[model samples]
Target: MIKKAVRMKLYPGLKEEYAKRHNQLWPEMKKMLKDHGAKSYSIFFDPETDYLFGYLEIEDEERWAQTANTEINRKWWDFMADVMETNPDNSPVTVDLEQVFEL
Candidate 1:
């Protein structure tokens, strides 16, 4: 499996709402991630800086790429656009982080 890390910016003062949305995450979205080889996905938020960190492991690059094109993901992006920095397409403005070291 390959570990992926990404970062994005969240709007200030929406920590609770962000957490609430994920707590009640759409079942289809979760299923899509798993079906695409994603495992142990998790996100962390830093309220002070409005920075969001996401991590996940995936075994297949092709499947992982397909996950981003799903309709459910597009809907989820639209649902979250109001609370985070997003592109015109409503996808979160994410920056993939390079791994410098691994134990």
Candidate 2:
């Protein structure tokens, strides 16, 4: 398994709405993630900077990347574009983080 971390920016003043959306995440999206090799996933927010930090463990990077092409994933991205910094395709503007140490 591989551990991945990424950073995303949430629009100012949309924290509650973001949480509410995730809290009611669609079942199809959740299933798609699990099917695509997400063993564990979590997202943390920093209210001060409106930054969202995401972490996930996956079976393989190639398998994980394939998730992006799924219809459900695209829909999910579109669903979240309003509350996040996203690219033209509505995918979140994410910055992958490198891990320097682990305990």
Candidate 3:
């Protein structure tokens, strides 16, 4: 398995709203991610900077790319765009983090 991490900037003061949305994540979205080989996923927020750190474990890292083409994924991105720094396609503006150390 591979561990992946990404960083994104969230809109100010929407921490609770972000958590709420994830807590009520759509079933189909969850299933789609799982089916695409994402075994585990999590997002952490940094209050001071409003930065979101996303982490995930996948069986095959390349398989995770397949989720981008799914309709459910597009819908989710569109829904979240207002609360995050996103690109023209409504996808979050994310920077992949390099793994330096792990125990």
By lDDT, who's the top model here? 2
**Model 2 Cα lDDT, one tens digit per residue, 1-103:** 8999999999999999999999999999999999989999999999899999999999999889999999999999999999999999999999999999999
Better-scoring candidate (TM-score), 1 or 3? 3
**lDDT (tens digit, per residue) of candidate 1 on 23-103:** 999999899989999988999998789999999899988889997799999999999999999999999999999999989
Q: Write the per-residue lDDT of candidate 3 for residues 1-103, one digit (tens) a residue.
A: 8899999999999999889999999999999999999989999999999999999999886788989999999999999998999999999999999999989
Error of 2 at 65 (Å): 0.4
The deviation in Å at residue 37 for candidate 1 is 0.7
- Against the true structure, candidate 3 reaches a TM-score of 0.98
What are the runs in model 1 whose C-alpha is more than 4 Å off? Answer: none
Model 2 regions more than 4 Å off: none
In order, candidate lDDTs are: 0.93, 0.96, 0.95
What RMSD, rounded to one decimal, does every model reach? 0.9, 0.6, 0.6
Candidate 3: C-alpha lDDT: 0.95
